[model samples]
Target chain A: MISSLKIVEAAENSGIDQNIILKFILNEWVVPLNKKELTLDEEDIERIKLIRELGEEFGVNDEAIPIILHLIDQLNHLHLSFKNNYCH
Target chain B: MKNPYKILGVKETASLDEIKKAYRTLAKKHHPDLNPSNKTNEAKFKEISHAYDQIGTNEARTKFDQGEPGEENSKQQWSSFYNTQQNAGRYANSYADQFGDDEFFENLFHGAHQKRRAQNQDINYLMDLTLEEAVLGVEKVITLANGKNLKVKIPPGITSGTKLRFAGHGLTENSGPPGNAYIMINVLPKAGYIVQGHDIETELPISFMEALLGAEIEVPTLYGSVNLQIPPNVSTGSKLRIKGKGIITNTDVGSQIVKIKVVLPKKSDPELLKAIKSWNGKYDYNPRGEK
Candidate 1:
């Protein structure tokens, strides 16, 4: 299926700082495909759109969202490795 | 949005048997008749019906199961939760903020912080899910009282108590950076599966003879049941591991752990008794090992 653009457009529509948009990509919460190409996938567009919306709706004032996200990543990796080593 | 697996409360990866099973179970509980007090349940019943309609057919479940969420005009959005209580007045939902009379939001997000804000504050929405749904992932549409609709894209590999966000669709206008809706999903536990640190542990009862002589027993996992080999002379409480048969997380994968509970016969026949008596006299076996 073609990638959607709703996500990126949400950011554009909201006029949010482009930095948050860049941060989302850096964090891998959102992925970009074919950087060489000008076209954005539907998923990329839509996800950005939603991220833009989530910010406005909740007013999540914490700049720590990225930190929390990193924590989530660390916790998941740790949990997986722990399970790998554990028996029964 | 029309994933039938969502209606039957099954996953895209669910087998036909699994889907049927889920449908029966949900139908029994959420069928408007069984549930009366909850209008939410009634609405859920409709949703299930709609989902089933899309998935019950072999042709449809196949399409939806393989397709990514949000096709055909469904939009998704999320605004990362920022730490700014003082600024809440500026970004609060205009409709919701109407009740509070907060002048802060009226002008701030609408006018003042235009250059700085990327999106609005993420909205918080609570979604109640079953353990199965949490493990397998599901698609749902959260409809607000105001008729605004959000068809959620629940990605595969989420766990119980996992939170998902939909960006910039909550009470904010489509004009400014729309805020995200944070869906804090609570998974209702089910019978049989035991969730531990990334492992789904369960006790599979095996016959004494099987445990003593080693046998192949079926064990359940998130993927399904696989025949597990129990070594002969295996004692009760022995654990069997199926590599890569554990939990699947959003960020990574885990394994399943099965504990074998050896079951003994409560009563024995006369021949068995005689044989046991002779064996007991000869071997003098004690389970506690003369502690």
Candidate 2:
């Protein structure tokens, strides 16, 4: 029952340009669920927002973005696993 | 709410370039993404960013110098930015075009800006539903942050984690169409039924006598009760499928799966004990095939 948004909808919702979202996909910063359809989930939208915040607000350059995204993904994965282990 | 110039450690007369340099220097040191393990850096980074946003451009600096503070200052900055973007042909269907003759701009300067908020982000509301409410459709009224009551019709057989989108019902923005509201459904755990996709699974407790001899037992369903025939020699964990009695969704109608649980008599009967003792190993059966 996970809801998905098309690429255009994702761009509109995240307030990022479609071209930037395309660039994010090209750079593999955000992976779409369906490559052909360019369908994105809520996670992808949040990632796009994070990328925009990092680039626009924090002035982080393009090169450093992927590194930060990877680190964030790792942290999220660890946090989820930790929650599963302790909370349940 | 501290002085923007003082927060960035720049003089009031500092140029935009000098302010930008100061912001970059402080931002690099305090950026939360760069210093993810540090908590205070996040707040410091926000302070720096806020200071920069307050006085980053000439227009914003001018507004700041005029002693306009808080959200009013930011709204004017955004309004001015929108005007600039509109004049540059960036926003084709921008806010200016939408409210061209509505006196919105006049209202902006007249301090009536609180009537509208610039929201371009979709809001997610977590909706909790009981198993019965989910299986059977129900209409619910939810109060949003704007104090607007939205009546949402819960569709039948809606599963957990399903998102119901309300288009154009989100926060009204200053420019483009309002964002959407997504209702995320989370079904609470029910006592008797376990939801598996569209199907419902529940245990039917029957006496050992009923298991030994065939009997018609009444089983509870989401909609109503159904009489199920328990065949002779039914074992524990055996599932009986009642077709089209589970959940009815738009796509499909599911079946209710009844798991058999045979319960023994709490008190032993003298006649039964004597009969069992008389036939101890003579009619013994190995259920596990251990023999």
- Clashes (backbone N, CA, C under 3 Å), per candidate, total 66, 0
Predicted candidate 2 versus true structure: per-residue lDDT over A1-88, tens digit per residue = 1257787766554445565576577656677767788988655665665666566545775546766765654444433334444467
- Per-residue error for B33 in candidate 2, Å, reads 76
Model 1 per-residue lDDT at B127? 87
Query: Which parts of model 1 have CA positions greater than 4 angstroms off?
Result: A1-88, B1-122, B173-177, B250-252
DockQ of each: 0.04, 0.03
Number of the predicted model whose DockQ against the real structure is largest? 1
List, residue by residue over B1-291, the lDDT tens digit for candidate 1. Answer: 334655576777777778777777787788777767543455456656656655776787666556633352133222222211012211222223233233443553467453655554566778887766666556789985347888775544455455665555655654567676777877777788787865777888888788778988777776677988888977767877776555553222456778888888887678878987888889867878867
For model 2 chain B, where is the 10-residue window of minimal lDDT? Answer: B85-94
Supply candidate 1's per-residue lDDT for B228: 89
Residue B218 Cα positional deviation in candidate 1, in Å, after optimal superposition: 1.5
What are the clashing pairs of model 2? none
